[model samples]
Target: MTPQWLTSIQTPLASAFYKRCGSKEKAKADERVAVIRDNSQQIVASLRLRRIGGHWLLRALLVDPQRRQQGIALQLLQFVGAQNPEPIWCFPYPHLQSLYHQADYQLVAEAPEPILTAYNVYLNRQPLLLMCCNR
Candidate 1:
């Protein structure tokens, strides 16, 4: 089921995600979607799924500050994983490795060229985990 706010979330999603990631530059040029709370008419979370080098690169998952720790991000990850059973890759911050692992994403040592290039540019100096969901 597609969220009703999917079409209108690009700007707000980028804003919220950039705020959390501490880099407005990281939110550029990706296809994104949001999870909206039907009862409250608010977007609870957002994520980007970009096709890079024939693989789905799941990136920039962000939950509303007040909505963190409520399993919203995991739900979004699971939903996307279910929808795209093909290999899905992501570079998650070290702190989020366990969360992604709980969603069935495993650490990957290698990735496609586009993904590897992006990782080298964005996270090579950091302790981010490169993960993938192939189930």
Candidate 2:
């Protein structure tokens, strides 16, 4: 996909993705990874990135809601995964762990982390689950 530029540049794209995923407030956020636009200068999708263990980590990978399942996310992941030969660990949301597992990431151990208020509210109680993929 082609990279995009924006005039409404706001917060960091990674933060916007997490907040969007966490709060489901996509309309209110403008931060993005790579902004793809057509002619009118609108944000189509984001390829947000973050860091882990002192290494650059991919945090959010989103295809404009209308253009999903077309392998955009997979392409983005492949691009990021190839950035370095070092192992990449994705601490995914519970529902998404299976996707990673399908990508050959084995469940290594359960992560025990402090319960954030938002998740704690949804989980009835918070349980930290962890998984890792070997390079």
Best of the candidates, TM-score: 1
RMSD of each: 3.5, 6.4
Q: Candidate 2: where is the Cα deviation over 4 Å?
A: 2-44, 102-104, 110-129
User: Where in model 1 is the C-alpha error above 4 Å?
Assistant: 1-5, 8-30, 125-127
Please report, in order, the local distance difference test score of every candidate based on alpha carbons. 0.68, 0.48
Error of 1 at 87 (Å): 1.3
lDDT for model 2, please: 0.48
State model 1's lDDT: 0.68
Tell me the tens digit of each residue's lDDT in model 1 across 1-135.
234225443556555555664545344444645454535565566777777777777766777677789888888887877777688888887788888899888888777788788778766566555555544
Models 1 onward score TM values of: 0.75, 0.49
lDDT of 1 at 106: 87
